[model samples]
Target: MLWRPFGINETIPTTIGALTVLVAGIVPWMDVLNIFDIIRGASLTILSTIMMSIVLESIVFFGGLL
Candidate 1:
């Protein structure tokens, strides 16, 4: 329904439709690892940076320069 990739939004995701149809499924198919995969990688990198910050803060709290 989001995309009007047919004769002016005529085809629906149903068996009766001319186009390919899938009743109920995942939208962004994370299993295939597309854009979501890149987002996940970026998130992981951010989390690693947060961990590094926490470690540095802890070290400073314990009287360390780094």
Candidate 2:
């Protein structure tokens, strides 16, 4: 048989758990960015910093740093 992802038997709760963790991890820094300030005066500075850091970490994670 051909290969298949998750064996076509995935469940909704598992998917939700994964997505929840992903967002929780990112939200704090997003809060710092002040994008929340569009209505309150916060800015994008922190969000930008977080994105750049993720990119750099991704590179290193892929062994580009070596």
- Global lDDT for candidate 1? 0.62
Task: Please list all clashing residue pairs in model 2, or write none if there are none.
Answer: 37-42
Model 2, TM vs. native: 0.29
lDDT by residue for model 1 (20-45), tens: 22224433345445766669989999
Deviation in Å, model 2, residue 20 alpha carbon = 26
Off by over 4 Å in 2: 1-42, 61-66
For model 2, residues 1-66, the per-residue Cα lDDT tens digits are 365576754566578875787677955666555654564433366677788889988778646633
Error of 2 at 24 (Å): 30
List the global CA lDDT of all models: 0.62, 0.65
Best by lDDT: 2
Q: How many backbone clashes does candidate 2 have?
A: 1
